[model samples]
Target: LLGDVKAAGTEVREEYRWTQERWDEYRRLAEEMEEAEPSAKGLIFLDYGKQTLTSDGRILNEYRFAGKVLTQDTKWWGTRAWYIDEGINRIDVLYARSISPDGTVHEYSPDDITFSEPTRGEVFFGQGTAMSLTIPAVDIGSIVEYGYIDEEYAPEDPELFQPRFFFQSGEPAKLSKCEFEVPAGRELFYETFLLDANDPYIGQTIKELPKFVGTPEPVITRTDSSTIYTWELRDVEPLIWESNSMGYTTIAPSVHAGLYPDYSYYHERFGRLHREHIKITPEIDSLARAIVGDLESEKEKIAEIYHWVQRNIRYISVKGALASRFGGHYAQITLDNKYGDCSDKAILFSALLEVVGIRSYPIIVMTNDAGFMDRSRFPFWGGNHAINEVWWDGERHVLDATGNLHRFPTYSMGDCDLYYANYVRGEIVYNPPIPAENNSMQSVTLVELRADGSAIISDSMWFTGDMEAGYRGYFEYMPEQRHEMIVEQFVSQRKAGGRLSDFALANIRDISKPFLMEFSYEVDDYTIEAGNYLLLEVPALRYSFPEIELSDPNFGKKSDMTFMRTHDVTFTLADNYTVRFVPERFELSNEYFDYVANYEVDGNTIRFTDRYRVKKLRIPISDYAEYKADAEKIMAYVKERIFLSEE
Candidate 1:
């Protein structure tokens, strides 16, 4: 985050200077890079950059690039976009000029920049507006330079202080430097991940790093009134693209500095605000009772209230002051309005649970898709969303009411494997990545092959855990009349001539029970024609594999998680045809994945059972070849067709 204060922002200095000697150094660096890495020569690369954090909590983020139109690929580098949150930060452009190859310069004015919706990249503007600028006239070599100061003189919450920096960028850099200056007596908790070769905890999260001891030791120097820490890197390479990569944060050379001693300190400060907003009134008590009136067990009662919040509260992205935005408004206020953001819903949910004598805490977290976060030792206020955690039956159940659709005790997929914290625990808690079994789908299908080369297929499916939320959430919004059309669309995806016949559903609305759905469809030309045989594979069956290519020898491992799926099917043929051929029965098991398929034949019917389980999520670089081979084999085996010779 660039800044956190609104009105009390910083201003850039009037005078700025750049030396001709600096340009000469950049030119030499660019020439060296072009010769060494020809593949990257046509792409843009950073020549020089510096990020400085002042003792007064202000930031000076600056950059200078080797700019040229060597190819169409480098043309896009002429434009640059910066996110400016009018409410949280005030940004002042220190200098934005392009020095032509002929030593002439063109500077951009205030009128040249346009404000629009902010985009998430190296910077997360956080629901703020963005300012973009397009450089002028760049046919030959150029040196583009720009710098800005983000002022957050006063933050909404003084206790919330997290100033982090990533030494690595999306593009290669010749020189990059970062400095942090804090008051001499002020202490900060910090950690660095994958920063350099000296880092022992590379590609691993070290939950137990000694306090204040970072691998890439900075140049420590003390001023009369402040302590300055400096870190520098030279000839840094860009992070190459990898399929299903966790995120740039996971691989970057970064350091996160926390103002507080630990997570407990931040919780003690903000948790009080959280409790203040969750005021449980008589109205909340009455509603809590009414929700679980018919429910029997504690799990049922919890499910009822959780689902009630999901269905009732409408999500509105509205934030006022810092207190209201972070701690949320009163529970009664959210209930009265019938709409609120993620934090508001979480506050209301926790309040209702308290009314029923249940212990629940509103936990703040950065979702899995966002990126990995430092769990607890360093208390950084980086979480952007809030959810509820209920303590019942000697266990904790994580629940999210924001998505507007989720079963009891089951988090939305994004909510899993998150860095979670709450005022109640006063400690660090991270929901480790879940196994495939935790979120799974099971299906059964019955098919009837007719004499005229047509087939009727009926599927009964059951979803559990996260998969349940995924399927049930989609149909919850669909009108009853469109259910048939939706099922028809799914069928048409498999076969063009497939038409929906009849369908039935169970537990679509009643999330307390496992989600179950049944649908049937008819397909024309169901089998391939041979001289004396009919050939066809099972209908309504497909595997869900990551779309990774085996073509790249330089490809790395996958950091993404896959799910578990099981399918059982029964197929019957007309009296005129015989069950002549069936796919081979096979079983394959490995550390990362497991697969088993069994095919049985009896009389004119064929039965098949298939189970695919992802034992582990990430496929490391060393295991990529083996994982790819097994994945490809499964894809091929599933495509094997059955040849039913006519008798």
Candidate 2:
């Protein structure tokens, strides 16, 4: 019963068949018990999963779920489990059994399982189907157990395998164990992560399991014979969601097992596979030429191509078998369809670059989970995202085609300064860091105070790099009416009861240039009037400074903070008013940041300028106090007011 239920490229035997009548009967029984009363504090008794790898390169995975439906709210847990895939032929739900509180037991054969195609949203273009069935005779205190097996050949490298086991779950477990069995004489390699070396229960069959040292580096082990690796955790507590916890994979105890000889094999294999699909077709060449028509500079040409891809190609997630996930479709197909996932878009862009004689390579990256990569853990399945890197102007530029709103030559903030897989080189590479100056915002404001206690202000703001990317993304996705509302809100927030007029945005669609926005507004009662005297307060050009308190317990000790800004303002008072008070020039500098502010008055005009920048993007936890102190200093300087009086 434990052997291969069905082999690859082999017919299923008659003994494994289940008739349609049996399925209908099980469905009827489930429906009859749909109204079962609820239980208190739904709890799971056991949850187990297992996987076996055969010498023939086929993976068989199995799972067993045993839980009690304590209450109506928790009925969904024990009702059903689904094994869904577009490649349904490779999936099989063996059987299900349920024992009621009164000791009556009911069993469901394979034929009792129901198969149906579920509806998917447009965003999921080519997702497959689902095979699902409800457990029979389930009620309060009932024990429901069901298991299924799935077999699939790894698309990229059949011999390469990645196995992960979580030692914790949302529900407390009495026992949890993950076991891996490989055919004898097959090369086996693995690394354990986030496990306590001091734990006495941890066991391994290999003699060369690296000693658990101080740091939590991956412990690598290799064996030639058929190997069995088991990781077990007893009396585990429920994993509670913390406010700002790192990724689950980072904190969870698990093992990554692979059969590949080295990282080089993965890189070479995937590089070759991906290159085969990146054909430079005639259509691609023509499109590239059209996009870069008569553009002399390489930067300009790249900008044009990058912009075109962002504007034209749509993003749709199509997850299925390994082939569809790893061996993405050709670039031409993506162009024709006008939609593709990250890999599809990356491949298409790479092909387009090739057409223009520009050298580029596809890079595997993790968008939000960069911590998953460990230098010691060399596996091909490192990254969940794929992007392209372009070589231009003697420098490398990372491009993410799915970033529809990002400006050319500047990638989204998450895409910058991260480690990615250089499959061609068979190693990991850290992307070049963007300077704080490149990711900056500058604003200029002119204010004219009237005798009527009202004022007219004209302001212009410019954004570059990641700051530009944010505004550009807003303009791209926001409708015209909503954009106007946002502008109005922006003006009102600075000056209460302010009205905006002549609002204009520049370089919103021009990806190669910085983003600009200019607006004129009038605020009522801008000055406080007291019996033949007026008091005017010059508003701060920038009101908020990023704050990261070192004392905050929830603050991630490993995280870093970065910020940069510049502002200049001029206030022209009416002839009746005179400058009464002005903040003196102020300067503050620390290891983490620098700030400079100057205020000047000449006749009826007051001028002020300020600049603040974070010296480093990554501040160690030990330096958090210094960074926080610098930020506070900058905030205090900006909040200082300049006063005007009527003569």
Candidate 3:
């Protein structure tokens, strides 16, 4: 079957043989593919066989193809694959050519001195059909072809061959369905976009360029059913009502029954796995002993173990076959054998912690690649990653080991917004975080215009706990470059009147703390003008506010929706400037808690301060109207311009 397919195309010919030697060679290749799980299209593995092969599907002269002697004897097996081409070429191919009882075909184009013609042989197994080839190697040439194949080894579906590209998530969505409670005036809107049926990539496709994942469209929209897409709309009330700070709302009985893949399916799969693998692991035994031996410190011990597992095991992505084969649940395997996927590591770590008397469960997280996971919808393959949930001392904390960061148990700001599936009180609920905001920094810069055309600049900044972690991690990855980049951006804010020649930085206070970055800068000729009196303008501090415009017609006369971030900065200028202007203050005032902004001056120095401390975790969208009013006022103040006037 494999050999005959190679012969049909003018580009190459296929041949096969059924001799004992040939059988042994192919058997090894088949086993290699099964072991690596490269069945997911475009996954490339390299050959570690006795013989070395180049990435361009080239075999060294000393290798054998179809039992025909080349330059040397073929020693070992190497079956790595990537989706280099679509159609018949994309299938598994052992070397380039095969010879059995069918016919002979070209497998590889070698850069040989002789340019020898491909030898003819008989086909043994597959003949006349384009054989699938799996070449295990890194570097799938940056771009590859993608297409669909049928179960019968025939080109069953739409035969359009297209170029496929890789996309990673950009910024993660900060809000999901789990964040809010039903209020009398506010309606909850939910939208989910499915991938195009024909898209080569799985999961949502509305991603920023270059990266596959990022913030979902703030405004939910639609796309083709087969291609990755989003579901979003105007203020549609919730199908089921929720109140208080409850974990989740139950889908109606009718909805549950009609929903695809009922909770019962997950329950059974998880239950069986727990009975078989989890119940017998040493992790369980150790945990049981810990609980009984020392009741006093069991809580701390369990927390420590949970943290340890997350730190030691890094997340390697194994999306396609692993999920399909494992029934889309979490389980642990050896790090060496485990392949470092999100669920595999989470399951292992959770079970390990469980053995040590810690209560942990698998967490299903929709990666940045997929839009938010709405519990209202039933999906089999929406989310692409899994984490672990630990409920200790009545508090739930999420753990992500597969992230691209280090020394972090919790996810970053955007990552924290993913939905998870957990057995809560014997029921599976799609869980999102209670908070609908992200951690970030707010940096305010103040520029002092001088008569000499130079300026004295100062900056103040604050960070959230998670933002600090990310900042520090980034610095660790590239200390000099990251630090300089940050410093440069700050200085750029000091736009001078002319092409400033000299640039200087000073008073860079240490930012080792977990939630704040404080520093100031002094530069010369920072954008000064030479017309009578000097003109000075102070740049507003960098805030975490979303970039919004109210002009879009798709949305009704509603203020743009924004989320929370971990920052607040204000700039104050002394009234001594010839041109006097000041920004107005704004506030988010509710009876419970408010984030207010105000400015004050004391003698030579001006003072600006911003306060952001939301009292409640969840804020209903009905409250957005009031919040938007406050935010608009504050932003207006910040956008106010200051200029220098000469007498």
Give per-model TM-scores. Answer: 0.87, 0.75, 0.50
- Residue 350, candidate 2: C-alpha displacement in angstroms: 2.1
lDDT for residue 534 in candidate 3, whole number 0-100 = 44
Q: Is candidate 2 or candidate 3 better by lDDT?
A: 2
Better of 1 and 3 by lDDT: 1
lDDT (10s digit) by residue, model 3, range 321-433? 32322422344343334345555666666666666557776655564323333543543322455666777778777656554332223354434434555632234444444
The list of candidate 2 runs beyond 4 A from truth reads: 1-49, 63-83, 88-121, 130-157, 169-174, 196-226, 237-240, 317-324, 369-372, 375-377, 479-482, 527-563, 575-598, 601-604, 612-640, 643-647
Q: What is the lDDT of residue 179 in candidate 1?
A: 66
Best by lDDT: 1
Residues 1-647, candidate 2, lDDT per residue (tens digit)?
Answer: 11132221133335433345534444443333343312224444455666667777677676665555556655565455444443332555555666666556676644445556666666765555555566666776565655666666442345656666666555445455666777777655666665655422123111121222233233223456456666656544445433333345554555677776467767777777678778888999999999999988887877888888887888887766554466467889889999888888888888988888787777788754344355345564557788888889887668887767667766655555467776754657677445667677888999988876689999989876668878877886788778788989888888899998879888777676677889999987888665555555556455443336335422222223244688788988888887778888988887656888898889988888888776544344344566667667667766666666666
Give the TM-score (vs. native) of candidate 1.
Answer: 0.87
lDDT of 1 by residue, 502-618 (tens): 877777877667888888889888888877777888765576566347444333344355567888989888898887789899789888788999899999889999888876654
Minimal lDDT window, size 10, model 3: 249-258
